[model samples]
Target: MQPENVRQASYRGVEDPQRLYLAMLQDGEHDAREWLSTQLRRTASMADDLPDDPAQLESWAANHAAQVATDHTRYLTRRHQGAPRHYFANRAHALWFLQQVAPTKVVDGAWLHGVLRHWRDFRFHGLIRTFLEELGDGDPRCNHVLIYQRLLSRLGCDQGLPLDPSRYLQGVVQLALGRHAEHFLPEVIGYNLGYEQPPLHLLITTHELAELGIDAHYFQLHVTIDNAACGHARRALQSLRLLMPGQCAKAFYDRVRQGYRLNDLGIDTPSMIVSFDLEDELLAALQRKRPYGQFMHSDRCRLQGRTINQWLADAEAMPGFLRALEAQQWVRRGEAPSHSRFWTLIDGPQAAMFGVFTAYEKQLLHDWIVGDTAAEDCRRVRPGQWERDLALEQDAPVAQGEVCVDRMIERMWGNRHATPNGLRATRDFIHATGLTRAGPN
Candidate 1:
């Protein structure tokens, strides 16, 4: 089926990755294939750094691991020398990075879905296990997508920008890889190899996010699970070596190289982290709210000699209006938000304007008012303080009018994985695939 809103809703551009994601899920053979040829061509110029021989993959991974360890040690030394965060300038910046990357994280491990049905093949077990882990084996807490969803919810970053095409590249490539794997198994293997290797940035990001009181379990989870010693990194290499065809090996290796380089197609993490502009983000947030807010406020209150509605009338007035709020003490910049009269008006339920802003808008306003203290001046939680394992409360009460899932069984359905009948079918599939013979992925 299509994603939540593909046919009815229009996204940023005609080639939005979200559409391609569901399109690939729904029908990858024809439509998705037609689009991929143009996109995959761009990966042509990328360097083929992987070894030409499959047998050397483990050795290559070991060397890469050693180099990463050395680089991270150097990074730690610099940090201990009274340096600021290498990735984030502040908590707001960190939050922005998370939001920008949410499109990919929400569809975690989608590239392996195509490999799941190949569980009968022992070589496919590794990839299958990775996919299952991404699903947390049906446990809500461990599921990568669920964890990322919870992280965004906790930070009020659920309403993120989905307009950017770059935001959807990795995610689209992944979901499209169903037999987007069977069609290009070598490329999928190559992509997995590149993705599983833990980077120095992941380690530093995990450390810094915790220092900002952000629950970094999502990044932390990657750090631990992608470990070079015995984790997905090793698994990726092992799987590749075993699965690579013996004859026509050179053509397969060529495809694998192309797949490895595909990981480099989108904006890298470091570049995105350094790109945050607090004022620009704030201005954009205000601009989006301008239309709805333009006529909503009354003339009862005045700021800078104009009524609140008058202050918000012009798009150009947004910046000056912010200045007016600060000048009139409506917003106390660089201080605890509670100390400002404006903060109370939109924060608590008792406040007059609590529902005016969405969670994302409120976060932007909150961070802007709090200013520089959004990161440093805030109290830091010790690492692991907020890293508790989450358990799904199946018996939890649902209040009236709340959204709930009610499954409709269809005997002819395909992979409705969460329902009782679906789960039973999955178990039967697993049994049919001979999991015991395949062993641990």
Candidate 2:
């Protein structure tokens, strides 16, 4: 189901990011000029920590790499000494992080959208290669977005959840940049440069996520492909140098700096990681489930002064109800979840409430119950643990509604994701996009 926020009208928040994202993916125009103008204005007063001279990009990248490498070494040393995870508190936190970042993840490589038309131009080759690679060069197995989608699917996060609109801000900016490339080329180059420089958090996140049993391949891919030595970071600098005009070079650099500052505008990875509160998320999950589960229970059991139904009826009293559960012997917090009577009903094969809560809800409850006592049971889904594209293997044409990626691919290039006639249609369409040296999409 589409999240309510996603289905809202355009211009919702910073001009409704979902609509703008959809418009571009559908091969249609949704003027993001006003949105970009507002963002550009926001960054005008922000600090530009990037080197002033574009010629210094190589050294700037090296400095960044050295710093990240040093920090990662320290992080590993701490981990070796048995420090708790620096990012994820538990497996559930890792899944939550993945789901929360879906908006930005799905729009990977959007900033370089405008440069696709210049595929044949050697000057634009760096940017174009980066963009194509983002699309996995049309390979389904390697497509960044699809890989994330599969991760969510395995973890039961594919179904929409109520997400903060602010989560979409960076994605909206990316799509907007793609649509407004003619006016934002320098900005795109600058933004790409900032994004391609692998931060220390990327390394830490990949390791921690893997420790928690989540496939960190997506992040691991970025760590390697976005390396400063000879990866997208290098390519970003090359594109900036190649595209900078001889006339009014200072003005161009000013714009690039402004664009680089644009990276600071959105809710960043650190903020997202710190924002998670397991208890708060559990409360939300309980509230969502309460609506339907309110009357499902028998009136046989009562906690404190209220019956189960009565407690469930009052949404505003959720916190109190949880406290009541803990106050009684019904739930024992800060222990193995299996020890709690409340967890008993929701767990096991023949438990009365076995089917009442979703796998995600069950996970939330488990983590909340475990609390500070969480042990080393970190693995969630092992890599390639589930089969992908079973229907395609069964010789079935993918259902139209289920083919979101293929639908967009078809709209843009009259080809589906998987190909017939021995042609990798998606790859050919994207690679062959630049009909001329610098043509339009």
Candidate 3:
């Protein structure tokens, strides 16, 4: 039966069963693991194309299936603490974890041509595409769309201000030809922008790090960042602190104490501010061990120097960063912010990851503000009567025109929503414009 070969099944629009099978595992369906294990043995027996020895075949099938399952659990447990709901900071980390769990079909896009010649992964490419799409719709504070637009352009997509959504996530990047290009994710409604570019920060709780199978003894060696002091860089270090293993807490405390006394942050001295260069050092540290957080400090890193005295002042200066930090604790409580929280998530062990998370939030804000450009066009073209018609529509009851009005509301002012303050501004605009609904007349 050999599963009828994927090519043969293509006529029926059927894909390789392995993908469906793997998806089930990823979805955490109750019977997925058990069913996959049983199916492996059956599939092995039915496969006559390979070796004829049933015992060897079954052993191989079982091992492969088990390994796939094991990797999935291992990585998931480490990063997510087995919760599956904990936020991840960046799409790269998510993509990387997915690759580790399943490698067979995760190949490079063909368009990458000879660019990413060393890589191969179709599913990975698709997943990234899907994520970008969902991210645009799901979060108002998203900045990734434009940045990805640039990344896609590098892959040879056409030039444009607003990105072509399809090409941005789906195209292949020619990493071979490029070196150190920075992209901006503009300030959007719900998200506060610290840098036009990313690598905002990484945040990790001590509990999450422990689950990663890292020992606390090497906390200093383990949690290194590219530059310290840039807002994102500073937050990454603080978040990494939560990850200190219980055994290493004393050592961690001692080091921090020593660094404090010496007017240095010890291993964290680098974190006091952002640095301009350190990519090689960063890559080496990550490869050696999972560094707590690494950040692409803002372009300003070149200007900010490392010093404990300097850091205390720097932290005091970034009001947005401070508010963002306070609001994040509230986010854990599921409450709206009383005051604006901007770049707080950019600091902590998970700050880099937090940056990615915040980017999506920012996108949500941007979407809310832009709203319906057509209305603006209509206002210009049709003029006064259309305003009267819009006013008339507002008098209708929710049951009659709620959906349409909601759609109109979103369309007309989506872009105005890049931040909580923006929402207030929109409300003020509505009031000023006399746009409030009167319900059924």
Candidate 4:
């Protein structure tokens, strides 16, 4: 027999637009790919046309670089002149948006890493520099993704967004496609150029978020790190020149345009902002669960003169279900009802339906049921507060000798010149040291 949770509901049936887009790509859906390629070409045409002469092409890039810097300064000045409308209403609102896009955050660089691995035999210096930066100097803690994770934790959103492919937008999946399609080097580079060039959006986002008292480190990090003047954008252009010096320049540039165009293919930040309707989102979540629960055994649970299955089956029955839950004293309509059974089943550690809903889903339900209209109360931390907090969490009391030994182990693991046997010895030494602890594995 299926587990009660499995029998009652499944997250598998939920529809995700992003997932469908990816599936079409994987299946070699011709029409879809052509449509995407055409769209990319169209978007690229709006920018400067590629030059036939390689030297002229190089000059064009230099000119584009100058324009980008000028544009950045102009936009920053405009923002300082008058604060734009806050992109998010409050901290909670901002956190919700971040959590939604979390799955795709900092992921474009990882795809680039895979593409670079394929070209390792050729030894492109610019590509290698870009890849190393993406790797964060071989320190997992400093990796871009990990940095995003730290920000999430600071916001008390460390639980993470669901890994559902559907959660990602189409433009994000295109980055993965560019990387995975190793033969299409120009396209990959193009994607990198478009992705790395610090757009007006990043600058605006960082400023607006800072004004809202929310930590804007992630956006700020990107604004400087991906700057068109001397950062990833410059590196991406340099890499193109290094990899293919005057060979098939026009063809390569054309492909790069297509890759750049992919950035416009899916849901963007503005779309996310415009589509954020809480009641609609809550209703959609319940609807996604409706199919699985429709056939559930009603004998096990009943509410509102109907079985749990019946309550779930009707799209318009949620208000009635809530009323029934309130009638049974299982929910409090206008407060954080931690003691509510319905809440527990949806969110608790030992919940019958644990692992089914995402953090965002649970949050939506909590807000809806509580009728929460309260403003965000989370206090703003300073620029480096999250980093300081992380250091504190990682620091612990230990013997001086043990600390030295741990550092030695880390150094050994990081050494590129260390022999296999030497590395093995370092690992074994750490394991042996662990034997001193009193615990059963």
Candidate 5:
């Protein structure tokens, strides 16, 4: 069989092979089943598949790398402890194992990670150094792995940025040095995954740093923001020791010095510290959709400092505005099914951030609220919507039609907007009241 076929077939065996193995151990004896339970309990910890140390992770990568082509049987045998090594000599043996029962099931992703880690550990010590000898210039696998590894190392490094060390040290000094193992990294770095967007590099500049007035409290937090774009960084985290700030609190400021920061976290510095403003660019984009100041109701914009809670709490006309704005643009001039009505909303400090929608759509939404045009186009597609439709029986219901937010979020990034969390809460509350069933997402 081809390699791909063998791999697929092996996976089926991997998922289910419990009964046959127990039978083999039992030899059809009644006592064997009881003995198997005890053995099973002993091996329960193996299910965790934790690395013995940093070296073990590397060894795992190397082992899998070697198995990529040669000795498929040995590869399968090595997966289980106490299982005879090299028991399977050919693809047929692997197939037999799959058909037979096994004591435990192997998780697919975890197994893959173990193999990849073995290869990486081998490469780290120059065992397979040829792949990454030149850095940024090598075979595809070598280059990809090397670059990612480098990026992770850079992100993890602590260079001692200009944070106050005294406060950070306070957290460590408070810890009991004798009884507790100190975990310094978690105290310094924070990991969060936002939607799949590129790093906000422009916002990282020191100029922006000046605008975020850094107080002592901020330093004490030792906040490190991780975007998770780099795989090596994620992998290296296997060795990370997590501890309270009471231990090694200084490590937090050290990370700050090394430029450990988050892209999404806003700066607290004074606004005057920023040399350039994005206001012009934002204004230009807004002008393209509507005449400047068309949406301006009063000199004082209602959106400033408003949380997402407040925005969604506005009159029922708000959702209408969203629906209208979403419909103005057609993918092609005259396509059948159009775009989504709910744009992604982001909550910024002063503004409710939403994305590219047309002026006509925005106006139509305002009109829908107070009786300009009855929204007749909204339709329900998923079962959730059907459930939601039924709930709104007391209120007048529209036809079974509305747009899905998935398409908007996935395709054009149309769903992103700057709505405050509070505003989002209010919107969610209102939405919950309607017939729509909550989505699985």
Candidate 6:
């Protein structure tokens, strides 16, 4: 079957395989009855009909690489020639866009982690090596996810980690779901290819963000790491050859194509750029947080005709709510109105609605109402922070003298294999002994 056909088939019977898989977990579905696992198995079964031909498989891989390379060159040339408008209009625009897409970026290869673990568990060394390289040999500092996080932090974009899956773009969801299912290895590899293949978006993003004065290290890193000639893209192709040699070739290629096609299913950079409406996004952000804060205030707190609770209830009603507040002279736009009651509630420390929105969320609201003319200072960090944060603890304190039991316990507690539960139990045991720091009682 054609790769596009396979992707369409995979999603045909499900409303959204990504959401459905999440629901199945919440519903405690397990083993064969589990929706996610069932889907994985069904996907894997699709390749069962392909005949394994090693020569044909090698030819397909070469052709895939050549085609991808040609496409990459053509895209780059076209983008450069056209000199299209920046994906983000300015620094603020870039920051908001990054914050919106940060979740997907931060969890770069999380789904692949499952596949890596599976390979390790089953002693598939070839697969293990391929995935391990992607993970930078399990180094936390060098890990792509951590690198992205550092970029986010450096830019003062504090969206935090593990964002809600619902916030992800459909394309991001497709890539993630493909990796996570772990049923079709070929498809996952295909996804790796599609994802890692040097794209025009990364180049444009890096250049545009740099022009906007935001650190584009994350994009820059990916450009180098996923280079089609000598990086993850090349490695991904090599992996297919290594893992699916001989009789497994045909089936693997079929699934890989499907996974590759999945990359085309979601929003692309240019599309997101064109679709981003700051006003609409601000309203939507407030709306998402509305239900949680709807009953926060009573009728007595009504500013014009509606209570604070009433204003927070509906997204469509919010503009009118703001207008009402303006009519009551409670808020003044286009300036930092420290005395504005609504602004105070949305952004103040001691306000009743504190901690309700994210920094990015507040930034959006602040920019929308107050305008982007305010002189906002960028949060700067030391260049060494990334290296310092990721530095490996390579040594333990050596005991020169005869070790006491407490010292021994402490040493044992610090071992890498010590679990949190085990450490807690050990601490309890120590406390129960009534031993003071000076001596045992």
lDDT to native, each model: 0.68, 0.73, 0.25, 0.56, 0.24, 0.53
Scanning candidate 6 in windows of ten residues, the lowest lDDT window is 410-419
Residues 110-172, candidate 5: write the lDDT tens digits: 101111112223222211111112111112121222222222232221121122222121111
Model 3 residue 299 distance off true place after TM-score fit, in angstroms: 27
Candidate 2 to truth, TM:
0.85
Instruction: Give the per-residue lDDT digits (tens) of candidate 6, residues 412-434.
Output: 21111122332332333233332
- Assess candidate 1 and give its lDDT: 0.68
**Best-first order by lDDT:** 2, 1, 4, 6, 3, 5
User: By how many angstroms RMSD does model 5 differ from the true structure?
Assistant: 29.4
Candidate 2 lDDT over residue span 307-342, tens digit each: 889999998978988899999978898888878999
Tell me the tens digit of each residue's lDDT in model 1 across 1-441: 011112112123337676666555455443555445445566676555577677787788888888778988998899899877788776677878888887778767766767764656888888777666556554555656767777888778877763466677777777655445678788788888888888777888888888777888888889888887878888887787788788988888888877776677666777667778887887888888888887888788899789878767887888898899889999998888899999899888999998887766676777787776544644565433432555443432222221211111111022234334433333344334444324488
How would you encode candidate 3's per-residue C-alpha lDDT over 192-220 as one tens digit per residue? 11110122112232223233332211111
**In terms of lDDT, which candidate is strongest?**
2
Q: Which stretches of candidate 1 lie over 4 Å from their true place?
A: 1-14, 22-30, 373-441
Q: Which ranges of candidate 6 are over 4 A from the true structure?
A: 1-85, 89-96, 99-103, 111-130, 149-183, 208-215, 247-252, 288-316, 325-357, 370-390, 395-441
Superior candidate under lDDT, 1 versus 2:
2
**Candidate 5, which ten residues in sequence have the lowest lDDT sum?**
102-111
Candidate number that wins on TM-score, 1 or 3:
1
Error of 6 at 75 (Å): 11
